[model samples]
Target: MSADSTHAVEKDDAVFHLPGHPLPALVTLDSTDGSGVDLFMLSLRRPVLLNLFSMPVRDGRVDLPSVAQHECAQQLRSVNAELDALKQQMPELAVLGLSLHAPECLRRVREDLQLRFELLSDQQRAWTDKLELPLQSQDDGSQALRRCTMLLVEGQVSRLDFPLRQPSEVGRRAIELLRRETGTM
Candidate 1:
């Protein structure tokens, strides 16, 4: 393989485990609008807040029962509300949601929740597989992407919250980071 290809493979093999790690530049995700978003580029332009969530998959399709769907929606709403508050304080922040659902599914969720930020599809699991992100067991006993939040500043992870038990904590973590960075805490 070419040197560049080897370097790319090496980068992809490096699992991100903590804050201050650089996000791989080649990471791209499909937004609910069906547009490709290069997260590294977005972070370069402004701070990027990324929330990773997952829905149970059955027979290779998103499978969320009524109660499960309701719970997911509630979690998303809580996260969105926190992000809205954060956005009010920092307009330059680019809030995004990532999930294994298809773009169409994400679009529906976004519309249903009236989310203020974009939700990106990771159906192919490129971001998760490439980054080697942590996985969690679903209600069906299948593995799914673990819910986590990450704050990227200039393409480098500035803060990360893994195994997020409370979705609303996503925004609170970002706010805390901002406060510490600005010495306003």
Candidate 2:
């Protein structure tokens, strides 16, 4: 239930092994679709990828639901915007937003960050929970998810990123990897 464990102290040590692990069967979130879509189902069609981004700041620090403020939520929005460009660059991979919180809470994060990608709620996060991505919780209990990306080549583990140093450059990197894998680049 808690994503605290996902974020580990040694980011490089983050875990990502899904080849043997069947993808979770939870419902996908579709904020962009504006009608709530199932991301997991979509990924099943092809290769559904994921990247969890931690927020620099949070208002849930002190029951902010009663009193919270918009803070440094632009980071994810920026990344999501880049996803579009990245989409063009990859042209084949479907992007997914694997947030620490379920869609309900992630909804705010998405809105605050102004993200465009399809964000799915890994509630149990059966797949990401043990991955040790990155996390930090406020005294109030609201925690931040770490930053990482998981690539699925035909619904298989193509690559998994743990606390990636430069998610912004992920597009270029994905392009290069795709090129190598598909012999296009």
Candidate 3:
């Protein structure tokens, strides 16, 4: 490999656990618009808030999301609602939602919940595999992506929160970072 490529690899390794790691540029995630886009490329122009969550399993065993999951989703929606007010101040700020379900599945939830942000379906789990985010253990022992949030600035992950304890706090944190970075506040 060339020296630049070697240095890039070393840098990626160094920030594998850090906050400023560069994300994959070509993750072909399906958006609500039906066309697919590369996540890193989409976030390159500005800051992107990535909210990783999962839908409630509708198998024969359970029909509704657990209390914790429901609360998280509610908080995420709240964050999406708050983003509308910030758009005037930060035009380049964007919010993207991700789930492990297929596009159709996410579409139903998005429409039903009237979500303001776009949702990306990771049906193949390719993105999760690349990031190595853990799957949360269910009461029945199945695994799914727990609530996680990431802030990307210029294609680099500026902050990452996993096993998110307070969803509303995430919105505040992201807004604070954006304000500080953009000097708007």
lDDT of 3 by residue, 1-185 (tens): 22321221224332346366667767899988687967788778877878777655645233333523575467667667778665655787788888777787677667766778888887788877777655776655655776766667777766655545676665665565456555566
Candidate 1 residues lying further than 4 Å off, grouped into runs, are 1-16, 58-60, 64-70, 139-142
> How good is model 2 by TM-score?
0.61
For candidate 1, what is the TM-score?
A: 0.79
Pairs in steric clash, model 2: 6-133, 7-134, 7-135, 28-38, 28-39
lDDT of 2 at 93: 65
The CA lDDT at 129 in model 1 is 75
Off by over 4 Å in 3: 1-18, 60-69, 183-185
lDDT of 1 by residue, 1-185 (tens): 22321221223223244456667788789998789998889899998878777765666666645424544565577677787667766679888888877898788778767888889987788777766777777666766766666777887766665555665455576566555444565
Residue lDDT tens for model 2, 51-153? 6654333454223242223222433444565676566656766776665554556666656556676666655545555444456675556666666556665
Report the Cα lDDT for residue 8, model 2. Answer: 24
Each model's RMSD to truth, in Å?
7.4, 6.9, 6.4
Scanning candidate 2 in windows of ten residues, the lowest lDDT window is 1-10
